[model samples]
Target: MTTPLATSSSVFLQGLALSLGLIVAIGAQNAFVLRQGLRREHVGSVVLFCAMADALLISAGVLGMAQALGERPSLARFLALAGAAFLLLYGWQALWRARHSNQLEASAGGNGISRRSALAQAAAFTLLNPHVYLDTVLLVGSIGAQQAAALRGWFVAGASAASLCWFVALGFGARWLAPWFARPRAWQVLDGLIGVTMLVLSALLLRHALTGL
Candidate 1:
C-alpha cells in the first residue's frame, strides 16, 4: 500500500516532469519570451504573464473546467485557423528580419514600446494557440483527473511551480547568451530557425484543423 506522503511526492514529481516536458520545447511562445528576455524589455511582466497563464490553465484542467471547451468543436477549429494565420504572418516577419537586419539588437527601454504592448503580445502568444488548450486543458487535465482525488491538487501545484520556474529562468537567463547573439551571423541563424519553427508549427495546426487530427 502506498503511503499518503509517497503518493503525494510521486504525483508532484509526475506533474513537474510532465509540465517541463510540455513547455521546454522550441515554439512560438518560447521564441517570443526569449526575444523579450534578450531585449531586456518588460521581461518581468512577460514572464509573469506567461507563467500565470499556464498556472491558470493548469488549474482549470485540474478542476475539470475543460469539459465545456471540449464540447465546442467549432471553437477549436476556429482557433486552429486563426493560430495558423498568425504563425504564418509571424514566420514571414522573422524571415524578413533575417534578410534585412544586420543583427538582432537588444530593445532597451528607449525602444518606445509600452509594457502593455509586450504583455498583450505575450498574452496572444499564450492564449491564442489552440495546441496550448489541447495540451494543458485536455491532455493534462484528463491525466490529472485520472489520479487519486487527494493527489490531483498537489499535481497541479507541481505543474504550476514548474511553469513559474521555467519562464523565470528562460526570461532572466536569456541575457547570458546576449554576447553570442550579438553577431550578425548569429541573428541570421536564429531568425532562420525561428522562421522554420513558426512555419512548421503553422503547418501542423493547419493539418490538424483540416484533418481533425
Candidate 2:
C-alpha cells in the first residue's frame, strides 16, 4: 500500500538522518578511519568492515534481536567487565604513544600502523568493543523496535546506509587533506588529542561499570 511505502521511506530517511548525525561527531573511530584514509592504507577493508558491522547491528535492531540479547544477564556482565578492561588498556597505550611516538613522526612518515596491522586493529576496535554493541545493538535496536512494524526495516536501512556512506566518504576523503598533517609537531598534536579522547572514554566506561549503565 502507498501508506506503508510512505511510512517505510520516511522511517528510512529518519534512520539515515539520525545515524549521520550521531556518527559524524569526532571520536576515536573517526580519527582512525581518517588517518588510514589519508595514508591510503587498507582503506577498502576498513571502510567496508565498519559499514558492515553497522549493517549487522541495524539489521539486528530492526528484527527485534536485542530482546533476546538483552535478556542474558551473564553475557551483559561479561561484556561490561571486558569492555571496561579494554578501555583502560587502550587508554594507557594511547597515552604512551602520545608521549613516546612524538619524535618518530619524521622517520615513520605517516605509517602509524602497518597495512595488515591497521586492518586488524581497525576491525578489532570497531567490533571487539561492547560499547559498539550497546550503541548499535541496544541503543539503535531499541529505537527501531519502537517504530511501526512496516517502517522498522526502512529505518534500520537508512541508518545502515548512513554508516556505509559516511565511513567510505571519510576514509577516502582524508587523503586530500594529508598536507596539513605533515609536520612532527602536527603528529604530536594529533597523538595528544587521541590520548585525551581515549582517557576520557575510558573514564566514562569505568564510571558506567561502577554505577550501572
Candidate 3:
C-alpha cells in the first residue's frame, strides 16, 4: 500500500533520527564546536569539516569498512588512550578559560585564529576521537546497510542531512546568545559547563579503554 516515495521518506527519517541520537551526546568534539560557535570564529569551517567527516565515515561503514576496522582491537585501544589524554587537556583549558573569563571574547585577542588553524583543530576534533569511528562508521553504517538496496542511499542521505542541520544550527545559533554571553560571568558559566562536559567524557572514555569495552 505504500508508495516508493513514502517508503524512502520513512527510511530517511529513520536515518535522521538515529544519527541525531548518536551525535547529540555531550563530548569533546561537540564541546569544541560549541566554543568555536560561541566565539563566532571560523564557525562555518568547523561545522563543514565535522559534517563532512561524519559523511565520509558513514560511507566507509556502508561500504563494509567497519569489518576491517573491527578486526583491529589494538588500534582502538591505542586511540582510546590518546583520545583520553587529549580530552583531559581540553578540559583543563576549559577550566582555565572559566577562571579567566575576562579573556573570553568573540575574537581571539580581537584577531581570532586563521581559517587554516580553525580547520586543523576541527579536523583533529573530528578524527582523533575513536568513538566517532564506532558510532558514525560502524553503527550508523551497519544500520544503513541493513536497508533495502534501493533505500540505502536514502538512509545515508537522511543521516547526512541530520548531521549538517545539527552542526549548522549549533555553530550559527550560538551567536543568538551573544548578548548574555557578553558578560564575563556568563562566559565563565559557559566555560564551566564545557569543562565539566569534557572531564566527564574523558572519564567515561578512560573507563571504556581500561575495560576494553
User: What are the lDDT figures for the candidates, one per model?
Assistant: 0.73, 0.65, 0.71
Ranking by lDDT: 1, 3, 2
Q: How close is candidate 2 to the true structure, as a TM-score?
A: 0.60
lDDT of 1 by residue, 41-101 (tens): 7899999999999999998986773354367667656666665676678678777767864
At residue 1, give the lDDT of candidate 2.
40
Between prediction 2 and prediction 3, the one with superior TM-score is: 3
Taking all chains together, the TM-score of candidate 1 against the true structure is 0.62
Candidate 3 local Cα displacement, residue 4, angstroms: 0.3
Where does model 3 exceed 4 Å of error? 1-3, 65-111, 177-213
Q: What TM-score should be assigned to candidate 3?
A: 0.61
Candidate 2 has its poorest 10 consecutive residues by lDDT at 100-109
Per-residue CA lDDT of candidate 3, range 107-199, in tens? 323447888998988888889889888777766665565556678778888888989998897688876744554577776776676667667
Choose the strongest candidate by lDDT: 1
Predicted model with the maximum TM-score:
1
